[model samples]
Target: MSTVAVPELAVVSSPWSLGPLHLSNRVVMGSMHTGLEVQDDGGAGMAAFYRERAAGGAACIITGGIAVSDEARGGPDFAVFGVGGADERFRAAVDAVHDEGSTILAQLFHAGRYALAAGMVDRHGAPQRVVAPSALPWAAARGVVPTELTAAEVERTIEDFAAAARSARDTGFDGVEIMASEGYLINQFQSPLTNLRDDEWGGSPERRRRFTVAVVEAVRAAVPDLAVTIRLSGADLMPGSSTDDEVDALVHDLLPLGLDGISVGIGWHESRTPTVQAAVPHGAWLAYASRIARVVRASDHPEVRVIASNRMTDLRDGEAVLADGLLDAVALARPFLADPAIVDRSLAGSFDLVNTCIGCNQACLDRSIIGAPVSCLVNPRAAREVAFPARPTTDPKRVDVVGGGPAGLAAAVDAARRGHHVTLWEASDRLGGQFDLAALVPGKEDYAATVRAARAELADRGATVHLGHPATVADLAGSDAVVVATGVVPRAVDVPGADLPHVLSYEQALRDGVPAGTVAIIGGGGIGVDTAAFLTESPDEARRATEFGARWDVDVAETVVGDVPQRLPAAHRTLRPGPDVTVLRRSGKFGQGVGITSRWVALGRLRDAGVRMVGGVQEYLRIEPGVLWIRDEHGDEVGVPADSVVVCAGQEPALPTGDEADGRPTDGLVTGLQAAGVPVAVVGGARDARSVDAVRATSEALEAVRRLAP
Candidate 1:
């Protein structure tokens, strides 16, 4: 691999004056729910989290939804603007970002009926009824219906937005962005599918947009001196929702309002389309952005900047969209979580040095929807910066780290950066243990960037890395400390047909190859699901936004952009299914360990690929020449014909090879290191491997290395 992959980021690195707010660059750290806002310290913890990203090089920081009203909160964990001590904390956070020379914007938010929040109550402690334009229940909210805001209450809600903007201006925010996208309060009022009222809020398309337009008008009046913007659902992606023409009409209405910016956001929270997931291609929503940009530019107020956001990761890709001279900026949310210094690194012409976001959502989104503090899988230091500040060690010594997987690589990086002499050994020829195999899965090519980042970081810190070298007790005899991150090996499924030649482990299927023809997968864990996905390389995996819109029954005459919904008319070829794949679990949910935010998207891909999933395996009978017999719950014999069977039952901790001289079978090198009066640390899969998780692995490694003394 080369030292770096430089990005063409001229437009993104250039400064721009967005109305009253003069930004340092076009790379905006878009709003995301960090869960630190509602912490007991008010906003102190969140301030530290934001301060780091601003200092790292985000030009403008958009805060996660700051609740405008208690009843409209996204969740119970969201901090209401003037409630409790939030005002004081917001002021402190503003000062922190300003000290870093970055502009911060407070995004006034209201979740409406899409409140995934539970047990929400008002200031008086009575149960709060989630309010919306109509009394409709959010599809994913588990039958929780919202109260229809009376015409008077609707006016009050508009007032709430204005008050929040005034509070934000007084609290020292450089700008205010209205959170109207993602199926929130204002967006609910804009879409006819959710806003079914016959009143002034939702009779026609124009009336449906009245709520959002009024809020924008009020917010601008409250914060006349600050840069004001509103994030709008460019397509909404919902069936029977606002169409392209309707959204364009709304844009024209807002253009005359002299708003500072108009950000085009794609996909509502209830929409079936995959918005920011790994399956979605990079720059997927640029076309939606272009539509709004053209509308804004042709309007009377071209000075009102247009911003594109969604499924964007690279600065160069963002600049590519900006090079057309239509879009004023690009908004990125999760990528900043992966690498806060993404802009600074790219501007310095070292894009490869930046830790790219793989769109796994395991650490960030999965945690946020559950009201937990959001962190990054690739960069575990995010959100916990105050608790785990990076500091140089007073004393340095030799540190031998066994296993060059996620845990070991993380240990080496942490130790080396702290002034320790670090050495890493991996039994395999490659560094990434599971990540290398994971990268082979469709839509997961970014997994390879993690390996590249670890390798580059280790090399830069002068850490010794030995591939295909398994560390033994003798190898760690002279080390000050040892991190046994040897990782896990496949757990065999005990059954009559376990030894069949057709049976391949998950590792084998990923590395060697998945055999051609029909395939059967045993186990429905995350690995099993991914293996099944890898087995069938159907055209469905390459589905673009047009197909996504078509599948969801969305009207996309001018809304969606990308590959056409159907194969090119000139091809004149019928689509063929890739392969016949089946996943059989003993008795558990499919994609069990996968995050909620991405599990449905993965399952939907499998359905499109024609992959069948079968759960409730009563018993495994035997394997014949080309069929595996099994017993169902009804005691009926069934045979699944398959040319290959891959077992993804899971993994177990693996100790290093040839390291049990004293017959201490379980503790191999760890026992030797401990008995020799040398410090020893057993972390990651080497300690417990009931499951595979890079988040837990890296966090464990950080704490283990931090506790280790020379």
Candidate 2:
């Protein structure tokens, strides 16, 4: 790649001006459940997380859900903001973020009936009934019944919110956003389904909205200058639940509570939507945001600005929402993971290459549930800021990168930060190869974000980019050393239909849309199963009519429309693209190829989608025209008819021939120059030291680099 001048940036523009606080930019970091703080000093860990983002360039930071009271905590390990009272530690946390130059806020929450009190047994191991508006069993853990909050208990709980808010102000936090969304305590009180009470706090929409109002009024009165925000789930994505009209009514009712703004959020933790928020486009949750804006504007609450979130990842999308007046500002979570300097990049006008959130719920939501420290799937530096900050090394080292995928990108960025002049080469124009296809899968967009962030880091680090250029012994011409990150190649299978014309690989299928025909995918691994799902029809039923077009034959739709439910089912199903695709298990069943944890989740989606799964590859035959041979569950050989055949078996590395290796690419004049001696190092999937083949190849490369090293 040729050198290009990066435009200068103006640091003056900002996105929010709430009360006495003037935020530098519209990019707000949403609350993330950091498991690090859940265990030890909540104050220290919480402060570090916020300080990292603040230092990295977030205009405003919202700390993860801090419980208002122990009884209202969603889990035992969660941070308790209400416990410390108006203490010195709390003040220090607020001061920490302020010192980093960004305004910070604490999200005061009460999980209510959602709290797993049983898990929080005392030292002697006894169960407890956490208080709630009504005596209700936890939806997730049905046997656990929560105690109904008496009139006094309810009053005390409201006081907890007030106290937490007062403490947040005293601690020097710029603001506080009340957590009322995602079916938490405030949400439970807001919804009639959870609050089946006869008192003034239940039965009607006005009554249901009372608890939230009381907390807001208390918080606002306690901290006059602090930007008081409220986060609400406009649509819970639950069936037979409160309608949008009811939610709007609740918002209007709370508009008079003197809130600085209402931050709109969508979806529950267990929501089926790949992108949690509803009414949002692929990358932008404009619909849900627009609704929130409409509700607030319709109320004519001049003091309350609507801050929109839910799938708003890139600055371009944030700018669009701001331009359309749908929202005053946009809040994000995963984008910061991909690139901590999101705001700086946006200001520089390189928003097109901005690393964004691909909606992978792994490090954030998954780890939080498992009680593990929440980190980014792509950006490994998320929770390691204080301990392993990404800073340049004292002295520079000449480095060479072998692959151009996630791991390679990570290594390259880390090396560049160490002040290395790096050269990263890919034989193709595309930098993200397999990752590009991975992102095409539903909810796997974060893979692309990882790739984008890698490229940005490389550029910022001054790493030399060489595309469509293969490295040879001659290319190793000059350099202190090299690190081979050569990624893995596809694992080819020797099957009867392997050489068939229609038998396309997973990469090929993503590059080209799955045709409307009888599609049969071979292999039951993560890649194979996911490939099958993609080849089938989409699980989104609302778009089925227009999305199918002329391809909507009754048989085709039925075959493609597997068992994945449109709503969150009693049993969750793995979400995959379904457009008349079938799976033929060669050895193991579905999800065998993916990672264990991810496989279990994917298996659920597949089962829910009602996919026709066949085990064992022994019943196989040949790809004779439109027919495929497979054995049924009864161990009988069956002939399945298909219009197209696809192979998603996986990948391998592409190495040069012996002639090219010997510096004698005399086959073509051009091939000779392509063999320019270059020090190449490979990494990623195939680089696992345990694998004999990978070990040998790696050893050979290390030896070669050693010979060339000066």
Candidate 3:
């Protein structure tokens, strides 16, 4: 890894073959459930989405879980093979990818017990009963238990996979990968924890393998000419589940099923392992892939390719893993969302230009928690490629983007790319307003990389950037139009004694490490959680999976023995070594405003670090020397002992106000600029400062630049 060079990444672009299917490169995109699948346009939107990624350099793209049957649907937007208009969607996606000179694979899926049965209905518009190998509830299910599948019903499910594969083949798919991993129906049968039945589909390890083996054999028999593959779980990562011997034996048994490839996935959806979050190290699951590859490559069918998936955010890490020659390919899903041209740029030795996925999950995974279309935090035009076409602007204008924050930088890059003569103005000495500050926190180191990439992008696009030069109203008179992205300013805490010398802001605590003493965070939003993490950690210790394992006292390399809570592994973090940190919130969720997928991970780490979280603060009595008093929700006065008080109450819009009585201008800067005859487009927090969301900021900024006046 230490010797891996940037040029060597061309290996990912090297052509590879899986059985009869020949791919253009080794870089493959795993399936991602973009909520666009269930659209009524006969998959026109999903097709465009895939076409854009393919054009951007995705070689072999796997379609998000296409339900084999209506009962197999995972959530609200699953595109079922034979249900409703899903086939139209599947056909459109296949045609779209093939039109781009790339290949597509239909991932035949079944949610089993993981399906939200309460919200879904069958083709007949009746409640689709959730069923699994055994009548068991998923660990995350809210009092929803699946009905046990009968032996005949299990056979029908296997045939459902076969039927789905045939539909895909007819629709012109290059391959079909059985969704047998991720605690899905097939995975449910493989693990004893979920399959507690004594029936033929579950009884023993051999019987457990029967369901998966049947699925593979049926799907292969259905589409023998297509590149048949399956995403199998190399490690269930669940305590009291299948053992290493069982998983390895399953991989070996599948080799005889005429499969073209096996992409080894890690952990079940309910597994108590932190495999995909930001805290996990890049390439953390490569060993598991290597483990499966050993069983595949050494078998009689040696040519069957094996792919390593999960947590490989950067293609360089994928290249490094492939350089070892243990695995045939690497599968990354979210990285492609960040930058569709990630592979092409990396292979061209322009890796720095790629907008890498930092594994934040703020935009992709978190949005999925609420059934929203997955987009990228860095690249706002991800799934909405058709809506936000990247075509060069027809009428380019002299665009001046104010404030060098994420919003402003995004607006500048977008405007410059659209062929506008762009000039960016920043009041501060540096760019990357919030991003630069976010980079100071451990495990968020890739944020700095984003900033660097944005700066380089701006320079490459020939945009003039001015540091330490705050553009006055008159300074922007030369511009055809102005984009005001002046982000936000941290709001001052209004509590009594908030002005005390010991009371510091979140920016201050993050920029300058807190003093060596007890620290109390007043708010528990995103910044407060980060501040708590920053204060409790010592730079002397490591972060990532290694740090996470040490802090939580869990073995990242091995599975835990019991179904104790699913604790995260890995993330460059420290234990209870530095100042004692406490996060107190007035009310609501402790990790509110944080992404759904990330909030739990952040709060879990905080708990593991001995950070006391106090919610239901009715009153902030006063901030004294060594203690801050507060009223609890139960009308109790509580003393929050602290040596330093950090305010994480949030931020407000940083915009100058103008004369509203004239009705000629909205804000002072915009009014002044407009009076000078300079058209203005207000964006980011400057328009309306509610919360500091990089997603909303970048999205709105790009939209602003897109609609900028001529």
- Counting clashing residue pairs in each candidate, in order, gives 0, 50, 11
RMSD, one per candidate, in order: 4.5, 8.4, 5.1
The superposed Cα distance between candidate 2 and the true structure at residue 652, in angstroms, equals 5.9
Tens digits of lDDT, candidate 3, 1-710: 01222466767767789888777778898999888888787777888889888887788999888888888887877878766787788888888888888898988999999987677788888988899888889766788989998888988988999998999988889999888888899989999898888878778999999999999999999998999999998887888888888998998888999999999888876655677887666666666778788887788988889998887767777777787677898898998888887777776677678887878888888887567888988888888877787778788789999999888888888787778999998888999888877776655666766777788888988999999987777678778878998888888987788988899988777765566667788999888888887766543313345676665434453221111111122242333443377889987888788777777888887887778988888988889988988898898988888888999998988885543423454457777887778778888888877867889989998888777742
- Stretches off by above 4 angstroms in model 1 are 1-7, 538-579, 660-667
Model 1: per-residue Cα lDDT over 163-256, one tens digit each: 9999999899999999988889899999888888898888999899898889989998898999999999888888888889999999998887
- Which stretches of model 2 miss by more than 4 angstroms? 1-15, 39-45, 82-92, 121-129, 271-280, 283-285, 427-429, 439-453, 468-482, 511-517, 533-579, 586-622, 650-683, 688-710
Model 2's alpha-carbon lDDT is 0.64
Q: In TM-score terms, which candidate is top? A: 1
Per-residue accuracy of model 2 over 66-149 as CA lDDT, tens digit each: 777666667766666534332444565677778977888889988777776655853245654576788876656557777888
Which of 1 and 3 is ahead in lDDT? 1
The TM-scores of all predictions, comma-separated, are 0.93, 0.79, 0.92
Residue 330 of model 3: what lDDT?
Answer: 86
